[model samples]
Target: MFKGALDNIPDRVKVFLLSLTIMFCMISTVYANFYIGIDKVYTHIFYVPIILAGIWYRRKAIYVALGLGLFYIVACTVHDSIIDPDTILRFLIFLVVAGVVGSLSRARERFHSKELQAERAFRRVAKDLQLVLESTDEGIYTTDIEGRCTLINVAGARMLGYGTEEIPGRKMHQLIHHTRANGTPCPAEECCVSRSRITGVGCRISDDIFWRKDGTAFPVEYSSYPIISDEAVIGSVVAFRDITKRKQADEVRSRLAAIVESTDDAIIGTTLDGIVTTWNAGAERIYGYTAKEIIGRHISLTAPPDVKDEIAGILGRIRSGGRFEHYETVRRKKDGALINVSLTISPIVNNAGDITGASAIARDITENKRVERELQEAKAQAEMYNDLLSHDINNINQIGTGYLELALSAPNLDRGVRELLDRSLEALQNSSRLIHNVRKMQEMKATAGKLAPVDICPLLDEIRAEYSGARNGEVRIDLACGNHTRAMANDLLKEVFSNIVGNAIKHSAGPVHVGIASEEISLNNKTYCKVSVEDNGPGIPDDLKPKLFSRFQRGNTKASGRGLGLYLVKNLVEGYGGRVSVEDRVAGDPSKGSRFVIMLPASA
Candidate 1:
């Protein structure tokens, strides 16, 4: 209150008031010297005014001292007093008191002014700091050197379920950090905030917990910064935030990684350069290498020598963001055994959708490949038997025909025997035709002949001559094709026409009439040569036509030979990238005739 009143007075008015009080004191002292007698110590009354003037005016207080001194001398002189030593001493004392009091008072006033300015600045700074702490999302608080809470921001107060008024001077650890996450007691010595104050070092705790007012604990990430003053630790400021969501995300990632490690197929991850980055337990089991032995190595370690370029190609595709699905290839195991594997590979993309690496899932297919090889070998063996049987039967039929021809030419041969020999030779020729068809079928299975352009007109004419002579002029073949008509075919092209024409002549009742024609046709934006062989023979039934080209399908159940002719014709045509089909020469007239059509890629 005294300081407040002093602050309210103006400096000039204060100085004037002190001057008046000093003048009155001096005047009273002089009056007392005369009335109250000089022996009564009335001069001491002069000390009060002099000290006040000195303290208020500083060096200017000397003028007041001199004025009072002159007054006393004048008073003595008026009384005819001698020049006394006591009077001189009294004057010197007054001047000394004024100088000392004024100097001390000036120093005190300057000090007081500086203290008030500092106080105001400190208040402004404190207010701004409080605003920052209250507005932040993180909880912030400060504790004294003794671990007692000295200040807590609004956020901190609310976070711990306490009011700011209730938190001051409270033991910080006991208030909100009293227990560990595992429900165990946490001693103050173990508290990071308390430790920071003692150690004078900052401490950060990420996997700890802080309890709320409701006795519930949450995961927290916090740092304790020691507050330092005068090179000593005074207290600590703690800032903390909840990190429950981050912890949950980490858990989910760990679970997914565990699933990948436990799968049965080898799951491998590699960089764009084919350097292995991740190898799971399945990869260890299948590749015979542990994760420690394989990771950080090149992925080519598992590729066979002949297929090293295959790994490079796969990596190239992955770099281009390509995917490979169920691609069967061969890889080498730790024991140097080649194993067939089916691999599914995809690009590993980052969050920004940039391809950074590749991931592959490989399934061992060694057993499957083994079974496939066994099946192919068995099929090849069966075909070999068929080829051998057909070649031997053909040779035997040729020899039999030779003997029949000899017997027919014998001059003394009986007429009935000669007729029998002729019939037998015809039957032998038919048997030879069947054997030849079987051999051709075996050849088709064994190899698909290389294709080249062959003129169809001349080839058909040659086929007609061969069949007409073999049939003893019993069939006539008519050709209606351009002179330069050509198709992509192989040597098997003649067999295709032979089988169809033979069927026509053999099934016909009288002299067979077969017409062969060729034309250019377009399909699927590609040009093809279409050859048609129309015959005036008993047409195939609708029910039988569907299976007519199937192997071992005979026109009659009682036929003398296996019916592989049409089947072999179809296989050979398709081998040259052509197609074959049979239909009625006259639509809806099964008894009228049948037409065999072949379509081959047209050659320029």
Candidate 2:
């Protein structure tokens, strides 16, 4: 404000000249001393400028005073005025007055210089304070006792969507804090900021709403304090900032805590060093220990002594940013009873993707483990019982079949009775074959992956010959292959071939023609020996072909109704890292018989 008032004066010289003219007019026209002062007023015109310059310019006024005296002395000589004693006295007196003013001017100039230096320092400090006010992110404003804005910094003006010049003297609360967060009006008298001034007390409001010029409200955390002087509240200063993100963070934390408390599986949080940092309600229920007994303690506190080291090892891996999941182990309860649990550990990482800790979820699996043990025991008992029954049944079947055969060979036996005997013996034979296939299925499991290279050309030829002889009618079988096709196989490879060929012969309406072919094929950069056996008998239906190799598949299943031959073939072929599939011999035509294709890993 002082700088502004000084700027109104256009020139310092003009001010000095104007003031000097005024002083001369008064002194020359209106002054009269009791002792010849009227005549003495003539020299006073020169004295006025000298005195004025001395007071303003300090010792520099001496030069101006000397120039004026020389001009006056030269004018007296031209104007014919006598050089009287009193005239010399007046000139000397003028010189003495100039010296006296010069001393006074020095004192005044020093004082004025100090004032200017202090003003410049104040401007610099004010500039720094303005920069600070404009540069901050938080809003800062002050209000008078009447709740009208007295001053508002640049940040506060921008936050309220108002210009810095426009905010002062307006009611700040109506503009920025009129509406509550619940969309209700807020009374100025009830406002905390107003009360801070009216009551001379301070208040900190963490959750509130402040409005912008566009009438949008956002979450705010603000502090308000009375601006007091001499024990009297004059105004208030309020500082505030947006707290939207902080509020959202708090809400998310609340929901997560609820989930942790409500879970049925033990959910726990641990530090990298295996110290338990959090334990949920589920953890308490599963471990029989409350949160108060567990948190801040080592996780190994709950692990039994035998698995304590293993638990430490898992925590170590998780600390290094590894995930350990679904590990089944045993842990001792608070009551010293042991129970099985499936444990999973996952690393918890910060924004930098550095693992700081781990979360562990544990679910009890004692009942599942108990059921699994009982199932295994039941299967073993069933196997023993089957072995005993099969042994005794086979002996009875052998005796019955022998007696039927002897009766059929008797002389002059009726043809119908002989046919009955033949069918009975065949039925017994089929039963024995079924039993043997069941035993073979079990034996294959015991010797799984025990494969050796077997040349299949001889095996195919032998099955064709054996099946052809067994069929009474004209049954033709053709074999085409490389000279020697060796594949990874055990002795059971012959059984696979025998089952397919025997099905063709048995299911034929009359004379049937079967074709067998073998070749080498490449798949995924590996060599596999491929073979296809197709028959021209009444073919299988498209729908039934999928289940043709499964157990107890009868007329439509390429397997005997009471036998497990084809099912055993599927298991055996797959166990050798091979596969078996069936299709119609003629494309899309099931009545033209079926084709069984097999692929096996080629022997090296």
lDDT tens digits by residue: candidate 2, 488-568: 998878889988898888788668898999988889998888999999988888777777777777656333347477789
Estimate the lDDT of model 1: 0.84
lDDT of 2 at 290: 91
Compared with the true structure, what per-residue lDDT tens digits does model 1 show for residues 1-604? 6544654678898778777876777667666767767643346767766776666666778788888777766666655457667777888888888888778778777898899899989999988998899899888888889888888888778877778798899888887888887788999899888889999989999889988878888888999999999999999999998788899999999998998888879999999998899998888888998989888999999998999999989999889888999999999998898888999999999999999999999999899899999999998898788778777888899899999998888898888888789789978987987777767765666566667888998898898887774456668888888655799877778899988887887777767889999888889999899999999888888888989989888775323456888888888888989889989999999888999899999998
Clashing pairs in 1: none
Report the number of clashing residue pairs per model. Answer: 0, 1
- Please report, in order, the local distance difference test score of every candidate based on alpha carbons: 0.84, 0.81
RMSD of 2: 6.8
Local lDDT at 83 for model 2: 60
